[model samples]
Target: MQKLQTLFAPSAIAVVGATDREGAVGGAIFQNLQKNFEGKVYPVNPNRDVIFDKECYQDLASAPEVELVVIVVPAKVALQVLEEAGKVNIDNVIVISAGFSEQNDSGEMLEQQLIGIADEYDINLIGPNSLGVISTHSGMNASFGPALPQTGTISFMSQSGAFVTATIDWAIQRNIGFKDIVSLGNKAVVDETDLIKEWGDDPETDVVIGYLEGIDDGREFIDAARDVVMDTPVVLIKSGQTEAGARAAASHTGTMAGSEQAYEAGLRQAGVLRADSAEQLFDYARALAGLPSLDQNTVAVVTNAGGPGVMATDVIGESKLSLATFTEETIDAFDDCLPAGANIYNPVDIIGDAPVDRFVEAIKIALSDRNVGAVLVLGAPTAVLSYADLAEEMGALAESHDKPIMGCLMGGKEADAATKILDKHGIPNYFDPARAITGLEGLARLNTIRSREYHSFEPFDDVNSDRVEQILSDAVADGRSRLGVESMGILEAYGIPTPEGEIATSPSEAKEIAEQYENSVVMKIVSPDIVHKSDMGGVDVGVKQRDVEDAYERIVTNARRYQPDATILGVQVQQQVDLSETTELIIGTKYDSQFGQLVLAGLGGIFVEIFEDTAVRVGPVTDREAATMLSELRAYPLLRGARGRPAADEQSIIEIIQRLSQLVEDFPAIMELDINPVVARPNDAVAIDLRLTIDEGKL
Candidate 1:
């Protein structure tokens, strides 16, 4: 945070490569700084003696004392400047030069060298290809962007420099204020986690907003984000998850829990609100920055026109917020003050001819209701009504209530004039009713995130770590990438219930194992090469003791015929439980590149792909989160006894999920794991099949 303060609020800044050259990036940066920067600026250029009436120095060593250095030179020269800064003991630098890791291999190497220099000098470096920084408090506009934003609590950051400049311009048009702005280009050293932590704890920052392309460290990001969200809401637009980490997975968990899923789970667990669009990013940020938290999540609409009122109602119906049911007392109050033709309901239509006073009366009555959590005022320019007057009333009404109030001043010229009045009191006014409700939804969503209980992952001491380690080690030593039912001991070692199963080397051994079962048994070909035993005709269910040898021979023959070169690693004879009394489910884990192990739970069996109903969370998942995951699944109703059926052992399933989360967290080498057809009975849950893939290199 201290380092961030230095980067944002440095007293003296030297612009390396600054010049009077037209359209040059360095000149633009210096011009921007000259606009409002309260601190002294030193312009550096080898060819020119003076730039913009200020004397220019040849390099950092020649420049007078400067607290921070902004490098805008070419890639190689930027490295030389950085080395010079290190030698001069300048510990704060923002490299606005491009051609870093985002470029070619040589550029990546250059970025690494920059990091090396910064480390040697104990420098707090921002970026190798960044757009520079801005602080409204310091009156600095160091970035080569458009006009400085008006002072406000919402501070913005973006990985794309173009996005920063464009958003700053757009934010001005939309009347959005920014306290500080950052363009995190290349993000070699200072990344999203650093910005979030710095701004989240700052007293001036009401809400932390950012546009992040990637999170460098997942665990560190989650921890940093979690630390601040309890006090300040963090909204981000993470835009690079499309088709990321999408591979031909060996298990359902691996195939479904892609990089996008990992990011979703990570962000959700960290309690950070994710905005899918640019409009949504500001919509949430504005609401968090300006309005009070929407606690009840039920909204009442007050409008002059019925159509726009209906639109607000529709948006409220679709949002997490509900259409507020006004109390009878509030309805009666509206009736007394409104015109005869006015409809005094939840969306109390005060008639098209309603005056500004009538509109105020309707909204005031709505706010007075105990049932109404929030209020949305919609108005179309009418002959008798004054939108500006109503805007003033809306501002006053906003101050009177503790609840959030959104206004839909629906018009062009009239609404345009009224918006300025609403802005003063922090009342968000939109041209459309839907946008107003959407903004209200953001407040509700933020409240939900803050209200949620965050739990810690308590390690289950009952788990046998030693046994699990040996199982994974043996598999890795064998050079086996995939483990079949033969490695069920891994599940058993984690205290997850698996059926009585053991590898049978011969037909006699298979018969002996089947005879021990009360009835018939399940025989499956045990080969690391055969992933789907059923598809290869390598499995036979209900194999009686008498016919166990024949079934084993047929299974082995089928597997050998399917893949003649495949390793014939004997067979697995397992006890068969009644499928009719239990529900089949699939639970699996996949190590995501960004967020590590992602534990997945949902409908099992071969139809998992068809259903595609699953819940995912980054490990290690706590008991509450595991239960929440199960409840999130579409098949959760079935587990909860939806159709007069006895409830499955959901508690047992949660326990198994926690154990699996621990297993994956304990050994990240277990890259992908699938426990399909894990039977869930009324009292107990049993694992039916196991498929695991371990990364030998990670082990």
Candidate 2:
């Protein structure tokens, strides 16, 4: 990796296409550099004699002793300027030209040409279409935009130039200072992962935040984030987590947005807090920056009203976080500050009429409690209390306390005062209690994920690669990706407990297989073209051995009638496993063009997509991670013996997930695989049905 310092450092720099005219990108670039930069700046323009009181050169070849070159010329001219700059050993270049790789075919061709030239000279190019870069610590403002206010511990990276400037303005409003800001337009040479890796290690940057439309190398980005996020938190506002969002992002930055599931999985594995919006990006980053390490997720809410506290609890229900269950000892301690009938539970509501001292005492007691991981103080002005004084006291107590303190200020004018006071003290606060809970919960969540060290799964070198390859080749040769039931069975043999079954190529074979099984069985039409068997009425269930002779004939008849166009592949006959008391689980893997293979888990059957009740983790999920993923799901309660039912063996489920994760991580050509209705009984789990799809050249 080329040192990031070389990219930002330049004793003498040249700005190509610098002009005398006002409001031009080149002119703004030159002027901003002149205003903020402590080093010498030279402007390059054939027509202009001088720019911003600095002598202008006609080209980079004529510029005196320049190290870094900023190219803000037209697309055609920028290419020529870079070539000239390269000749002069100017290895660091920032191309602010827009037409390359962002407009049309010609632009893409031009971008490739520029990259080839830079590669030949071993030069580092920031972007062919970018707003350039900014560094507050270096006092360098080479970007063509309004100067950013330098104040907090964050480094911002954006794919959009407009968004870069907008984020800078937003940061100013929130009193957040940036250590460095880079706009990666087109990503002609450098990319976001490179920035994440660099910024994550920078001492000046305590937290790294990105406004990303798409990643250049999804796996690399994730690994880089995972490597450094434990030390310096990373928050990303990824723009493409939905089909509509993907389309919008693709159009916005010209980067292909891959599967939303894959993106979500990658972010979670990397421990990146994926924010939904730009505001949440900074909001979450600000909160994470100041948080101290904590041992638990027990939060103490000090709200003036009960409604906000209840809402906070509901929101917190998503994570492992819980409101602190106040012990009788702690309850007795809090009695000194509360009125007779005030609710003294976890919320610790001081009622609407409590004074500043009452709120302070409540907070002190909560903080002193060993069980409480964090404290959330909610302020709603009443006739009795001064919110400013309460906020100040809360801030003071937080400075001395071991745990993090967040504020949720309600009401009108009182909320404004609370925000100002907290903002001044560099304390994280929000208008909604849910946001506060989310912030506090992050502290505990971070600690939990960090405590569990992730060990990468060993490669499956012993698996039957030859057999798997032969099946994959056959599927691809037929111009089909979906595997037949027999092929799916072959795939599942590589994993855990597959059902005892046999494929019947003919009605006679079906009868023989049916005779072998004593109990009722399931028979499904197996066709490579049939992606959804039940949807096409190709499945026949509950055929007893006593009725096999007639049932086999009816199964064949229905299979052909339902899909007359589809080839009459064989029927698969298997014993009908009892599902009355077992938990239905689905494990699936899909290849994403951006993020690579992603492993997904959820409650199974038809309602999976409808309920959208699922969780994803990147490929090769460790056994512990798989357990955590299951435990994190909203439906996990059902799996864990809900309503007096016997709880499923969670370790068995975790083992199955580990195998599935390894399969996906090893076989990149497998575009998709699904094991649906994995029946988890009290002691074990079994896969009832399976599907696998392998795409050619996908590996």
Candidate 3:
């Protein structure tokens, strides 16, 4: 936090490439700084005798001591300027120059040099391709973008310079103010994690909003965000949600652990609210900033128009929040004040002809009700009512009451003045009742997150880490990047139940193994190369002892025909597990490139391929979080005994998931693991099939 203070609250600043040339980036920065910043500003330009009427220094050596420096030169010369600034002991820098990392190979190399120099000098660098930084609290506009915003509690950070500029323009038109804004272009040193921690502790900041294209360190970001959300709500909009990788996945986990899924899981686990659009980001931010955290999900709506009231009620019904059931006393009060035709139900319609006094009385009654956690007031442009009066009364009533109040002013010309009045009093007004309901829903979601207790992974005493390590070591030593049937041993070592199985090289051997099982047996072709054995007709279930010989021969023949060059290691004979009265689930793990070790679970078999319904979380997952992951699945009802079916062994499934999380945590080289179709009964669960993909490079 101290290091970040220099970047945001520097006493003195120097623009390294400052100039008086019109429309130049350096000149724009210098002019803005001179006009808005309260601190002393210096210009470093060898050619110019003066810049913006301030005497320009040839270099840092000629200039007075400054706490921060802004570099706007080319990428090639930026490093040299940083070196000079370091020599003079400048502790902070905002490299507003481009052509680094975002450009070609030469640019990437230059960025590495800048990072090296920053480390050597212990300097806090913002970016090599950044716009700049702005601090409304300190009255600083050090950026080369537009003017600074009015002082407010919401702080914003973005990766794109265009996004920052566009958001600022939109904010100004909407009268939205900010505490701080930073354009994190190619974040070389100071990234989102640093800013989150700094803003989390900033007394002036009430909420933090971010626009990110990608993150450098997923784990670090999650940890920082987790801490920040405890005090200040963090709303983020991460782009590239649909841009998943196209690699040939060897397991169900890898197929489902797309880049977007990992990010979603990570952010949810960290208690951050994800916004789907720019509007939602600010909508959620404004509500979180202006209103107190919602302690309950029940909401009451008071409206002068029945149609809009119905709309608001419908939206509330769709949201996580429920319509507040007014107490008998509150209902009686509303009936006494409102006209006879007015509906004093949950919507509490006071009629369109009702004046400002009637509206105010109804709102007061609803807000005063103990059952109401929040209230939404809706007003149409009626001739009898003055929007100005209603807006003022609503604002005051909201302030007087302890619960949050959101307004829906439902027309354009007539509601404009009322909207501004609501804004002035820190009451958010939406043009549509649905939007107001959505904002209230965001508050309820935030309350849910705040109410949850923090959970951490607890290691099981029965886990044998050494044994798991040796199993992976042997797989790598045998010149195999993937483990075949041998990986089942790894699951058993972790206490995960697997079907009884034995490898048979010939049909006679397969028949001998099948004879041991009373009911029936299953046979599958074993090969390191074939990830999906079912695709090549290599799996045969419910095989009798007499048919095992023929099934083995047919499976081996199919494998040879499918891929002639593939390595075939005979057939696996296993006792067939019945799934007629059981639930089939997939429990798997994958190592994400940015965020390591993600656990995935979902409904197994054709449902997994068709619906793609799965839930993921960063490993190692705790017992409680594992349950959460399962509940997040769209098929959760199946496990909960839907349609009068007996509930599957949910606890056992969670235990297996936790074990899989531990497996990947122990051996990161086990890049992808899939225990597809783990048959779960009412009391027990067993892994029906297993596949493990190893990446020795990670080890």
Candidate 4:
């Protein structure tokens, strides 16, 4: 962060390949830098000695000592200019040149050379192909983008240069300001994590927002962002989401989980708020940067129009935010101040003909309520009301009150003057009442992010790591990347209870194992090539002790029929669990390519994929996180004893989730695992069936 502060806050800047030529990238960058850069700006171009009437040096060597160098030459020449910048003892450089890693093979080779040079020089490089960086506080406009953003608390970074330019244009019109901006294109050196950490320590930045296509190191990003988000709210609009395509995934967990789900969980675990669109990105940012943190999740709507007020009410009710139920004293106060024909309720509508003073009085009353955490001022344009004056009064109320406020002065251009006025008092004005509710929602979300109590991995003394390691080694030696019920030893080693089971090579052995179980036994054909035993009629549930031999013989015959060449590893004679009062649940882990291992918990059984009611989180989950994961499921009600049913042993299931996470994290060889139909009874949870896949290469 200290390095970044120095790199970004340079006293002198050199724009290499600066030219007077029309339609050139260097000329655009040089001209933009001259417009805002307060420090000495040297233009380095060997072909020309003059650029935009400023004297240009022939090369970086000829130029005076500079703190930062902006490279805007071709991909080939950009490498040479980088070497020159390094040789000149410049510690920070921004390469705005294209065709590096984002281009072909030769371009990638050039980028590698550039990385080597930066490493040797210990330089802080911004980009090999980027729009560049901007520091408004330092009055530095190092990017090619034209718009110079207003000076404010929000700092932003984006993967796309075009996004930064467009957002700047939007911010200027919307009056949203940024402290620092960076276009992190082909981030070879400085990435989003660096900027997040830098902004976290910077007092100037109030909120950190970014337009991310992908993260460089997903795990590292999570850890870094989690540390900073509590102090400075981090908002992001992640564009691309990935899925496991054409990969041979052996478990139900791997098939259902994707990089998109990983991002969803990873970002949440990191205490970062994800935005679905660009509108949401700044909508969250503006609110976080300007408004006070919401003390509660409830909101009170004070409006002149009935319809818009209801719209605000609807959004508040639907979102995590609730409609504030004003206290009796506050309601009586509203009745005293508001005129007749007004709906003196939570959405305290003073009628459409009401003026700014009536609206002000209503808002004052709403904010006075202890129940109200925030207020939404939605006023439609009326001849009787003055948006400008109303905005001034609201701003005054905002200054006096501790509760946050957002407005919906719903009109084009008519509300512009009021928007700025409200903005001055840390109150954001929105055109849409629904959008106004979201602004308040952002404040509420920040409170949650700040107040979150993060939990670390819990230490379990009962688990046996050596036993699990031995099981994995056996699989590797056998050249088997996947296992069925035969792999239940892994669960037992981790102290996760499974139905008493033993593999039988012959019908007599199967019968003997079945006789041990008092009620009945389940015969499942064990084969490396066969996954879904029931589909091939290789599974027989509730087999009597006398029928165990016939059941075992029939299961093996079905397995051979399904796949003739499959190695029949024999049958697993397991105790049959009574599913009468138990809930069929699934607990599994999918090794995501980007965010590492992800643990999932939800409705189990065969329909797990169809229902898709699951919650995922990064591996090494703690007790609290495991419980939180289960609570996220829509079927959470069932586990909690919904619909006149005995509640399942949810705590026991949570233990299984944590133990599985520990096992998976302990051994990277275990790629994907599924403990389906984890029979959850009133007092105990047991693994009924499991299918685990391994990465032979990892083993």
Top-scoring candidate (lDDT)? 3
Candidate 4 global lDDT: 0.87
Comparing 2 and 4 by TM-score, which wins? 4
Model 3: residue 464 alpha-carbon error in angstroms:
2.6
2 or 3: which has the higher lDDT? 3
Per-residue lDDT tens digits for candidate 2, residues 1-699, read 476766766787788988869779998888888777868889999998877777878877788987788898899988898888778888789999989889999999999999988887878889978998888877789998797467567888889999998877866765677778889888888888888788777888888888888877888887888888878888888885567644322110012213666777788778887888776677677777776666788888887787887888787777668878877788998786689878788888788878888888888889888888888887776888887888798779878887888888776777776777887666777787767776776666667657657777765454566666777777778777666667764455465777778888877788899877778888887776665677656777788776655666665677677777876667888888887778888877766777776777778775555565677776777877788879978889988999999999988888888887777676787767777767888988888777776657774
Reference-based TM-score of each model: 0.97, 0.87, 0.97, 0.96
C-alpha lDDT of residue 292 in model 1: 88
Q: What is the lDDT of candidate 2?
A: 0.77
1-699, model 4: which lDDT tens digit per residue?
137886667899999988888988888888888887788899998888678888889988999999999998888898888888878888889999899889899888888998888888888898888999988888888988986888888989999999999999988988888899999989898898889999999999999999998888888899999999878989998887754365766777887777778889988988898998899887888888888889999888888888888888778888989988888898889889878888888788889999888888888888888898998888899999999999999888878888888888999777998888888887788888777777788888778878878878976889899988888888879887778889898899999999899999999999888878799988888886776777899889889988999988899888888899998889999988888977898899988777888999889986887898999999889999999888888998888889899999988999999999988888877788889879999999999888888887776
Alpha-carbon shift of residue 84 in model 4 (angstroms): 3.3
Q: 43 in model 4: Cα distance from truth in Å?
A: 1.6
lDDT of 3 by residue, 1-699 (tens): 235877788899999999999899999998888887888999998888888778999999999989989999989889999999889888999999999989999899999999999988888899979999999877888898877777889999999999999988888877788999999999998898889999999988999999999888889888888888989999999999986457778876787887888999888987899999998898898888887667789998888888888888888888899999989999899888888899988988888898998888888899889999998888888889999999999888877877999988888877878877888877888888877887888899888888888777887779787887787777788888877775688898899999999999998888888888898898988898887788889999888877888899899999999999988888999988887879889888888887899999989864567777888998899999989988988889999999999999999999999988887887788888888888989999999888889888866
Candidate 2 at 360: error in angstroms?
Answer: 5.4
- Backbone clashes in candidate 1 total 0
> Candidate 1 regions off by >4 Å?
none
Pairs that collide in candidate 3 are none
Residue 195, model 4: lDDT of 90
Q: Comparing candidate 1 with candidate 4, which one achieves the higher lDDT?
A: 4
**TM-score pick, better of 3 and 4:** 3
